[model samples]
Target: MKYDQIDRKLFIKNRKNFMAQMKPSSLAVFNSNDIYPVSADSTMPFQQHRDIYYLSGVDQEESILVLFPDCPKENHREILFLKETNDHIAVWEGEKLTKEAAFETSGVKTVYWLKDMEKVMFELMTQCDTVYINTNEHYRANVETETREDRYTKWLKQKYPAHAVAKSNPILQRLRSVKDPIEIDLMQKACNITEKGFRRLLDFVKPGVWEYEIEAELMHEFLRNRSKGFAYTPIIAAGNNANVLHYVVNNQQCKDGDLILLDVGAEYANYSSDMTRTIPVGGRFSKRQKEVYNAVNHVKKEASKLLVPGTDWAEYHKEVGAMMTSELLSLKLLDKADVQNEDKDWPAYKKYFMHGTSHNIGLDTHDYGILTEPMQENMVFTVEPGIYIPEEKFGVRLEDDLVIQKSGEPFNLMGNIPIEVDEIEDIMNS
Candidate 1:
């Protein structure tokens, strides 16, 4: 891991909270993600499953965590199963976590190797009446590929047919949504790294620079600042490419008069910080571009204030839609006739601002949170509002990560990043 070790207390507290929520005599299991294959001899980078990491802080492949608060033996209550580390692995891939190291990282005293999992799991299964299985149940989840967790779940169900099965996703979705102070600090660090990247790009971007070059500059800054890398695939779209919401092909040459929409962020210790800023490619926004940029910025600012506790995700979005509708009306993009004939399912603002105004942001880019539940304190979210004017040959998106506060308004995590149209222009020109 490039980042410093996280305080083990975070994981300890998280486990306590999860165990508290579990039904009595039930055991929950979490599996690490597989290091996916690219080809015969190549493999994609190892990304730890967020739930496993949340419980055990084991960031390696082929790891497992079991929690049985009402186990017969006290030591067997919380166990970690890791791929055994050896000198050969040390020489080839680097140092895998030793038992002592795993204990330190996860705060779980009972640790076993992958080879002993079957024996250990058999003992655990015989004691617990119910087994909690982790599954991907995110609102936007569209997973077609079966994960390592899926395979383990299949095996466990087939082997333990008599045991009562329950879903762990619901509990995790509620728990992970509320940020621990330590987790919030890690996310703040990620936002700080992202700020460094954005500030570096301010100096690097200018007329005639390729979009890919700006992407390079941002990556350089993020790496130097000790971030693992982008939280998600970056969107370095310039001019009309910005109109495409998910544009990631950063090959276009940033023309003199166009705006570049940089929807990028850095990840520190698996915590994500999402930010989007549209800056003038030539260090100066045209008169009309500034108008659109300010409009988007205004929407983002207004939308962020709505992220306080007790706010309903659905109602919050509808309110934002109304605000955006008014802005679009003022911008002359939507006329009275357009508003009158607009479909209720697809509002007038959908033409320009199509995506949701905000989503939970944390360990995963689109982190876990139940949309039906009222907003709560310490829940982090991304407030992104954009106006894509394809006909005008540019788009504007302003976004920042924020933490829902107990009272007043949500706190902006990316508050340091320059967002003012004049401020971005000044830094670029300087």
Candidate 2:
């Protein structure tokens, strides 16, 4: 791992919280993500399952965490099963975690090798009446591939047909939504790294530069700051390309009067920070371009203030739509007739500003939070508002990561990153 070691107390605390919610004799299991295959000999990079990482802080593949909080054997209550390492395997691939190192990484004192998993699990399962299976139940989840967790779940169910099964997703969704102080600090670090990348591009972007070049510059800055590149696949859309919401083929050359929409972020310690900033290609926005940019910026600022606690996710979006509708009308993007004749389901502002204003942002880009529930304090979200004008050959978006506070306004994680038009212009020219 390129990032520094995190304090294990966070994981210990997370496990304690999760165990508190479990049924009396229930045991929960979490498996690490598989190192997927690319072709014959190649393999994609391994990403740790966030739930297991939250509980054990083990970032390696072929790892499992078993939480038997009510077990009679005290040492067996929290156990970590890791792939055993030897000198020969260490020479082939870098050293895997040793038993002592596993104990240090996670707070679990009991460690067993992968070879002993079945035997250990058999003994542990007999003591517990219920099993909690970790499943992907995030709102945006569209997983088709069967994960390592899925295989383990299948085997576990087949082996223990009599045990009661429970879903771990609901508990995790609620718990992971609210940010721990330590998690907030890690996300702040990611946002700070992203800020460095954005500032680097201010001077580097010229009229004729390729969109991919800007992406490269951001990658370089993020890596130097100990970030593991983007939180998601980056969208470096130049000019009309920005109209396509998920545009990632950054092959176009930025023209003189066009704007580049950079939807990018940096990941630190597997935590994510999401940001989007649209800047003028030639370091100066045209009169009409500035008008659209300011409107989006205005909407962004107004939308951010609405992210306080007790806000309903759906109602918050409806309010943002009303805010954006007024802005679009001011910009002449929507007429009075357009507003009067718009559908109740899809408002007039949908023509210019289509996507949602915000989403939960953390370990996953779209982190875990129940949309149906009221907003809570310490929840981090991305406030991104944009106006895509294909006819004018430009688009404008401004985004920031914010933490909802207890009483007042949410805290901006990217507060130091330049967003004001004057600040951006001065930095680009300086």
Best by lDDT: 2
Model 1 residue 62 CA deviation (Å) reads: 1.0
lDDT of 2: 0.94
> Once model 1 is optimally superposed onto the true structure by TM-score, how far is the C-alpha of residue 121 displaced, in angstroms?
1.0
Model 2 alpha-carbon drift over 4 Å, by segment: none
lDDT of 2 by residue, 1-430 (tens): 9999999999999999999999999999999999999999999988889999988899999999999999999999999999999999899999999999987888899999999999999999999999999999998899999999999999999999999999999999999999999999999999999999999999899999999999999999999999889999999999999999999999999988889999999999999999999999999888898888899999898888998999999999999999899999999999999999999889989988899999998889999999999999999999999998889877888899999999888999999999888898999999
In candidate 2, where is summed lDDT lowest over 10 consecutive residues? 388-397
Across residues 68-143, which tens digit of lDDT does each residue of candidate 1 receive? 9999999999999999999999999999999999999999999999899999999999999999999999989999
Give the Cα RMSD of candidate 1.
Answer: 0.8
Candidate 2, 288: how far from true, in Å? 1.0
Predict model 1's lDDT versus the native: 0.93
Ten-residue segment with the worst summed lDDT in candidate 1?
A: 290-299
Q: What is the TM-score of each candidate against the true structure?
A: 0.99, 0.99
